[model samples]
Target: MTATLDHTAAPLIRRPAGRPLRQLVVPYLYVLPAALFVAAFLLYPMVLTAWRSLTHFDGISDPTFAGLDNFRDLFADPHFLLSLRNTVIWTVAAVIFPVTLGLVFALAFSRVRWGGFFKTVIYLPATISAAAAGILFSFVFNYDNGILNMILRGIGLSGLASRWLFDVPTNTFAMIATYTWQQTGLNMMLFLVGLQGLPPEPIEAAKIEGCTGWNLVRRIILPMLMPYVVITTLLAIVNGFKVFDLIWVMTQGGPGRASETLAVTMYREGFILFKQGYSAAIAVVISVVALAFSYFYLRSVLEQEARQ
Candidate 1:
């Protein structure tokens, strides 16, 4: 009887290994459609863009190999440099302002009565089309008849009035403000979700230990929400770098090129100026940057999760 049992167990043990392979294959089969879609839309375009970057493609003619000439031209263009600077400025300001404001709002809302209502209100902007938001804000920021300037004048702050879309500094600020307003709710939502998922014991314990108000938030809540913070920060950084529509619709890369981002630069190169190859190079650069950021962001999130 023991010998028969052992013989049966051997087959069962061996069968488990084969089952794992079948399980793995089934999951892959399920994912195959998504994988193919990504390959077709994302991977193929990326490879093609990299190839196009090495050529002089004007979209109409056969592409001629340009070697590194496009890159050389990109480096030499002062407008490109200015665009780069403006992009960096936009990214930094957008990330800082929205994320900071989001954190504050998240913390406040978490502790407040009727917080869900406010959260919904704040997040409403995120649902609006960026192009439409840009158009709306453009009217608000208009020099003569804009609501913002009108409010400023009414408040006896007329000196603050300027051509918001035409001036470099003001244009950048207006764009950043618009971006912040749109994104803050998303960030707040992320934090709110994180807050909701937190274990209640630690919070209750902290309160019993005399942790209240800001102390409770700073010492207990903030530390617990680190994962959400990292996620929101990464998202903000990526979005900031990719911002184009609002800037494009609001300023069209500006009176000069004041609010132009890398995305806008790519668009102007590819579509407006008809430098397809150059635009491809710019697109590649932006893709590479985004990939690097996402890789690190995901890695950090995973590591933090493992530690927790």
Candidate 2:
């Protein structure tokens, strides 16, 4: 009876209060604020935009449900088709030119003396705002008295000095050149950072194996740098698709809309023409395209990693 009474009086062997519960809850609590913020801002806006794409509203008027009409109209619209073509061209150019040039310069800079000075000089262009770069290039591409034309005349290549921003294809290419000049710096910096963080032991070992200069790079270095290359190329492509400010400041989708990209067309539709629903549709399309590419890229990387 005394033993039974002592057992009854003793503390209950229940799980300790608070500790395990807090361990489970505290982590979620730490993440709650960020989750709420993303839900409110990004997720909510995305859902609302998708809804808006299915409706027709003139900003102030009550939105009318239009189902898939907006998407159908988008496909039928010739201007949108042209803009898509331009977007493709820009994406291709951005991925190829800037990434390649940046890689070349980064490798060269990594091996050179006074690399910091050269890096600063090369990366300076990235500091300039897109608008400023566009404005600067406008003057550089000016027809008759422009520095580019003057240089061409000086160097006996005057035939190559046609109105850079006047023709359709030429204007688009000229704009791309301007973007490449600015974007190269960013890609170069990214590559440079990757180059700096590389494990030096492998490189040193390769040197012992008579792998010097290009041989070292082609064999040991390039494979390791593949991740950076992929990232740089992806960013360049995305930026190219989303390019607006620079193109707007430079071409304004001019030369008879030859240089118009999807972003330009979307802006013209939504703001200039006040087709809110149409614009939302365009936004959805752009988002879809970007997301599709991003998803595929990440999936590919994951698959490749898993295989390795």
Model 2 residue 182 CA deviation (Å) reads 0.7
Q: Put down candidate 1 lDDT per residue, 216-278, tens digits, no spaces.
A: 988998898888888788878888888889989999997777568789999998999899999
Give TM per candidate.
0.88, 0.86
**1-308 in candidate 2: lDDT tens per residue?**
99998898677765556667768899999999999999999999899889989999778789999999999999999999999999999999998888999999999998789988988988999999999999999999999888899999999998888888988899999999999999898999989987987889999999998999999999999998887787777777778888999999998998877789999988888888888889999999999988877876687567646755
Model 1 lDDT, full chain set: 0.87
Error of 2 at 43 (Å): 2.6
lDDT of 2 at 166: 84
